[model samples]
Target: MLLDTPVRLGIQIRPQHVSYEDIRRAVLTLEDLGVDILFNWDHFYPLSGDPEGRHFESWTMLAAWAEQTEKVEFGALVNCNSYRNADLQADMARTVDHISAKGGEGRFIFGTGSGWFERDYDEYGYEFGTPGTRLTALAEALPRIEARWEKLVPVPTRKIPVLIGGKGEQKTLRIVARHADIWHSFVTPEELAHKVSVIDEWAAKDGTDVSNLVVSNELQRRTTEDADALYDAGVRLFTLGFDGPDWDFDVVRRWLQWRDGKN
Candidate 1:
């Protein structure tokens, strides 16, 4: 509906099954391969059905990645808003922003959401508020985080793009329209089209022009035309996830070809 430009590729490096050396190598290779962003999950332990399967703290690893890599933008896929105080989160993000910039400037995209992990809350002594309440908390935390960043001792090197990940029609998309620079949702082409329509309607009602807003979705298949169709529908940021230090580059290279208008 609001289509205009080409799409790019993002890769999520799971820090659980891989060694730091493995992750560092993966990052360098992705940079060489021309992937756009590198993301990590924000859980202390595995969230994929196993409590002790594998995992790492999102922010700390991001700091490491920030210092270790040069070109790719980096952030959590979606940091749980309820995990840390909004102000502290802002400070941490700002620190990473500076770290990534090193000296020139940093490129950190803030991908965040209302947490949905019950184990994290139960084990860590966090409130683990009801889903509705957690969403409400996430809603409240966002503005506060932005305000605190403004009050930080040294402001972020850049405005720091905010990406809201969720598909809750009543709340998430509304939040995206209100606050997000990019809206990351999971869907097929049909689902994406439906959501895009809803997003536009919400944007117009809220008097928000989302022309510059990026449409992001996970990459799960190998078909080029499916990727092309998504791009045609205004989706520009494509992200893929992998499970190990093995760091598969086949899918990444294929997507990069599409991203760069190669074969």
Candidate 2:
């Protein structure tokens, strides 16, 4: 479990039932408000609201955010590994990294996961493989993604930080132990402690030390006391989710105040 990392707050502005202009304004406001990381999700349809309501694609908006914000680190909460080829995903990440970098190493965090939403697959003409199949694909794809990062004409400006989101002990935690710089999940503080121990076991098996791997968890429904418990459990990165039509940031401001106190 991480010990010395600073408290950082991230916001995932779900891109559904809202206009692009509204999202752009929200982005600008979030950066100005000192949000540490800004995230969207990888999905074709609204995760909430009207199922067929208006929604934007993830990567294209992320590209725009790369140019729009200067201070905030940003990426998908978790891009679906099953949506695109591994090499292509790497190239896209490298390109965004270049775009987001302002005379320094870029702020793009390559947060990804094996795809899970079946509707996205069914409508997009991609196979809706079983969880095991998708996890297997993710395990295979990460190496190719890393390889492509090295082979690109203008390689990534920095060793891009990979954030893998999941809590599966058998497959997902093992993958996180092997490849991730950050591991994100929705588990509680107690669960986090147990999961981190499991991840450490996996790290030992992999012959790598993941001591520095940042533990990330959701803060949308949590109180400051709960967040403190998470902090005590070595969770340094806390993310709040904001839904669209009317994106609320009052909670974000409160979390920022909590983070400042912790730091």
Candidate 3:
């Protein structure tokens, strides 16, 4: 898990209970503040606060951000692989990648996961399959998604990096070993070390070299010293979450200062 990768900061601007203008402004602010990545989650309803609060769809908002921002890579924290058809998802990602490129390389990260949100599945009329089934589908769909990207009329500006979220030792890590360019999880440093070892084992079994894989973790609850330990534990990407209705960046600013010091 330890590679010579620079420490990077990301922000997950939660889309619940917020106006589009507010969300747009936050995106611009984060970009100006020099965040390495900007992310939002894919959900139909608010994860916190009022359950039926105002919320935006993920991919549509991402397309808008692709046109609006000039810098800072962006994506869903981890898109639910069970939501959309795999090929369609790839096409959407490719289009956004081109849109964000602005005549140069794009700033899109294809972060995905085997979904676990029952509410999203139930409300959307999608079958809420068992976790094992969902993961199996994800493992099956990824290759098709990559194939679709290659066959698309306008290919992506570059090979889009796949960010797989979760640390399940059996299926998720195996999937990550096979496909992911980055791994994001909220596990503790000790858990991270163990999971990385498991992931390495899976990588070896799959005959894949995952030493170049970037490790990411949440920073909202961790102290600077805690972050240092995480960095020492091989986490190069730290993400801070800002929920909507009053998206505060003061804490984010402090972390940014800490991030700058690390660099």
Candidate 4:
């Protein structure tokens, strides 16, 4: 049996081709629908449809979500580690954590990864290094981020959960095994099972136990049967992406119902 954790549903609100007001309304709607987590990706331009569509920055929107939402944990689905300095990223995460506290502990998940989109780097004047170099930079930055969190005044409301995304067996999975509280990836059930085993091996090598690490996967274009297979493969966190203009929640509702049944 997978981890004995309750099934959790997350929705990634792709901040592309949408207005801020459209996003705001959808956030309230999704929370009311009982999503466990809400996420936005770190990107400068739209990944789908019009490349130059209406896009918003990730962290700024996260800060807004921190203030606007009451219960659902939120962050960038995967913050690009190359975009900002490690110390600054830590401070931003800590501040957002406090902002979302609402008289209780924070509901911020520090989801991050080595960035891949070259356009974002080129247009923004940031270095678009090779994948190896980027992953190495990510490895170097994560510890600095953790250290900065410890040094922050009035530290995070809680030990903010770290969710790392990527499935590279060499660098990414090792990073996840060493530092992640949650691991997000897009893969088939078979691939996920193998990756989970790989993570366990890495964790053992690193002297860390990932038994408590949550396994997350995407839900877009996936069936309930697919979700069941993913669950069988040890995934507990399922996330669906909703893009804008018209952020429909019908698919989300069906998935949430499935989640409720699983829980």
Candidate 5:
């Protein structure tokens, strides 16, 4: 675990029950407020509130964000690997990576996962396979995604960081050890510690080094003490999510203060 890493803050702007205009404003607001990363989830419909509420596609919104923001790094909090072809996903990520560049490297993080949410799969006509199958597919897809990135013309501005989100010790942690640049999970400090150890063990087995894998976790309902404990346990990136209709900046402001204090 990289315990000495400086603390960074991220915000997930949930794209449910909200207009694109509202999302646009929130993106700008978060960037202006000095957030380290800005994320949105990849889902066809709203995750919470009215199930059939206003929603938008994730990659399209991300392309828009790539052009709109100048400073903050952004991407889907965790893109469902099953939703798109791995090669296409890589090409799209590369294009957005170019789009986000401002006289330098792009600010896109390729956060992805095996995917849950049966509703997304069922409604979209994708096969809702068993969790094991989905994870197996994800494991197969990641290397292809990486290879595709290399083959793409005018390759990505930087080695786009891969942030894998999950806490499963068997498949997910092993995948994290093999491929991830960062690992995101929602777990207690003790659980995080155990998972980190598991990841380290997997890294050894796979002959990969995860010594610099940035540990990430949510901060939505956590107290400062909780944040402190997580930091001690090895988390460096803390993300807080806000759902729309009415997005709250006050909470963001407080967390920004907390982040600044840590740095």
Candidate 6:
């Protein structure tokens, strides 16, 4: 388990209602806090609480973050798979991969999923396909993504870690077992354990060891007991999110201390 004892920590700094300066400050603080990974959402606008809220582009910011932070790994929490061509996505990731490889120390965690936001589709002039169709697109694109990664000139500094975030068991977990280095999902701890069991079962049949997978989830509310419980369930990476870069280091610092104590 990644966080079983010395759990790795992550932060999702979703820029909502805050300016770019504050966001930059938050990122720097997270780097200082020793958060393992930093993430941002991929939508053009806000997803919850406010429809007309401040937001930033995901991959563009990630590119900047790659150069800005030397310590923490960074990526989109979940890039909508439907937006970009698979080859294009691969190239973008490769570029960021190299940019972040300060002195050959690259840590770009590529996270993505089938998109679900209709507003993004409508506003961006993309086809709002059905869920099944979206998943099918993702399925077809994964291979092309991998192929492009292999062929991209000056390949990623290291084997870029692929993180797939989703909750669907049958389809999503299956894909995770096949291609992902880290599989992120959302649910209660009980549900998470069950899903892990199913993912393990799939892995056994596929001759893949999912145990090496870094299980991750976003923490909307933080708690010590719950954090420990998640760790006990073989979840190593715990992510806490703050919107608009209100930049509160207290929660991040607490988690860091917790991680140190566990170590």
lDDT of 2 by residue, 1-263 (tens): 66798999999999999999989999999999999999999999998769999999999999999999998999999899999999999999999999999899999999999988999999999998799999999999999999999999899999999999999999999999999999999998888878998899999999978988999999877888999998988899999898865777787788889999999
- Cα deviation at 234, candidate 3, in Å, is 0.3
Each candidate structure's count of clashing pairs: 1, 0, 0, 0, 0, 3
Q: CA lDDT of each candidate?
A: 0.83, 0.93, 0.92, 0.93, 0.94, 0.83
Candidate 1: residue 17 lDDT (0-100): 61
User: If ranked by lDDT, best first, what sequence of candidates would result?
Assistant: 5, 2, 4, 3, 1, 6
Write down the worst ten-residue block by lDDT for model 1. 1-10
lDDT of 3: 0.92
Question: Which ten-residue region of model 3 has the weakest summed lDDT?
Answer: 243-252
lDDT of 6 at 41: 86
Cα lDDT tens digits for candidate 3, 1-263: 65688889999999999999999999998898888899999989888888988999999999999999998999999899999999999999999999999989999999999888899999999999899999999999999999999999989999999999988899999999999999999999888889998999999999999988999999987899899989989999999999765768787788889989888
Worst 10 contiguous positions by lDDT, candidate 5 = 242-251
Clashes of 1: 1
What TM-score does structure 4 among the candidates reach? 0.98
- Return whichever of 1 and 3 wins on lDDT: 3
For 1-263, candidate 4 gives per-residue lDDT tens digits of 13899999989999998889999999999999899999999999999998988999999999999999999999998999999999999999999999999999999999999999999999999999899999999999999999999999989999999999989999999999999999999989999878988999998899987889999999889889999999988899999989876777888889988999998
* Residue clash pairs of candidate 5: none
**Which candidate achieves the best lDDT against the true structure?**
5
RMSD of each: 2.0, 0.8, 0.9, 1.1, 0.8, 1.7
- In TM-score terms, candidate 1 sits at 0.93
lDDT, candidate 2, equals: 0.93
Measured by TM-score, how close is model 2 to the native structure?
0.98
> Between candidates 5 and 6, which one is better according to lDDT?
5
Off by over 4 Å in 6: 1-6
Better of 1 and 5 by lDDT: 5
Error of 6 at 125 (Å): 1.0
